[model samples]
Target: MIAIDSSAQPIQALRFEDDGATPNSRFPVLLYQLKLAPAHDNASAFESLFAAHQWTPLWRAGIFDYHHFHPNAHEVLGVARGQARIMLGGAAGQALTVKAGDVLVLPAGTGHRCISSSDEFLVVGAYPQGQEDYDTQRPETGAHQQALARIARVPHPEQDPVTGAHGALMRLWQ
Candidate 1:
């Protein structure tokens, strides 16, 4: 189990490669997590620390896909279970693999996507609140795009009926 604590250590700014010779830069992202019982209210925890007006959870299973978010508000992701590979760029950088008990802080304007998942169910507590320009954009690609193209041709639940995207989630044995 790998644990990263941004509180103990100072938060550092991460850079991504840009189209030009110089790299693209942004604000520093601080990542951390907290443990609460099932009975514990996550919303209350967030409210105590920050003022927020909206909150939602983004869930996906199977193979990783591409998505981008230009956050108007700050977000805190609490890994509830399983494992996931989180990629944070349109360019190159280190992809973080997070497991249960891990916490990640995504500041405004950060673009990120999930790359993979483990055998167990994957769940995350997402709190979206407080701020101005949090926006998420997902470019169709890989299985997610393919599913959209072949939705009419494929006739199985595994083949995204709505989109026909293929990924590890479809292969899970019930």
Candidate 2:
């Protein structure tokens, strides 16, 4: 069995610059790892932690196909069930699999897509407080100078969605 511990999981920070095809940048895409395989998984752990951080629950959307990015707000995705290979940073970004019990904290402008997922794959997505009207912008459509500006203006959540303050999020995203 894969061991479970509080020690930081593999943290990946990817910087995506404007590659002409996609306007993704400024804030490096932060993929904070919470144990992917756990002895006991709390399905509601994300909702509770996010509430504590004031990142209001936005919606429960199974990741959609095709790369997409949020331009107006940062987001947190808690893997509630199943597993999937996720493409982050853009269509050309790395492909990583996340199973139940893993959470990803994505800053504004970070592109992500579900390359493939199990039938049961489920994810609970949330956004920072006051920015519930997040827009999904794809790299296929260029001209993001304005979007990048808006992305740059989006502030970091007061606390990490899953870990609250001083968690891997603040350490990495900050």
Candidate 3:
């Protein structure tokens, strides 16, 4: 399946604040630069790996080119092919390039959008078991408060998409 680079440094953790327009999460986003096992170098492998960790793999596609957040659920995106420069958080956020074998774990209400990408870019996305049908929210002047309320109510996932119970998510989110 997926093999974490033990020799590599620890996962990159990024924090994005609520930028008035987009209600970002209180939790930091977890970025994992995975080293896929030789025989598991495809989209299916990512899906299988996520599923095994209780993150239900539900979609295979490119990221949206506009800023949006999931207010009701967390998300995990695994880069299966090609590469892309993406913006995390709202207009006042950071841009990151994600290539094959990279995994991004976004907490509920974390804004994200694809800035630019290679033609062959593809990602496999998943959510915690019961959150597969997550909502897509864009910046709306009046909806900010409502979004924040929902975000506050969203529960911490019991398992990390890449690691199970005692993983980084469980530790950091606590």
> TM-score for each prediction?
0.48, 0.83, 0.93
lDDT (CA) per prediction: 0.42, 0.74, 0.88
User: Which stretch of 10 consecutive residues in model 1 shows the poorest summed lDDT?
Assistant: 155-164
What is the full ranking by TM-score, best candidate first?
3, 2, 1
Can you tell me which runs of candidate 1 are displaced by over 4 Å? 1-25, 33-64, 131-134, 139-174
* lDDT, candidate 1, at 57: 43
Cα distance off (Å), candidate 3, residue 27: 0.2
lDDT of 2 at 79: 84
Top model number, lDDT: 3
Better of 1 and 3 by lDDT: 3
lDDT (C-alpha) at residue 72 in model 3? 95
> What's the true lDDT of residue 68 in model 2?
84
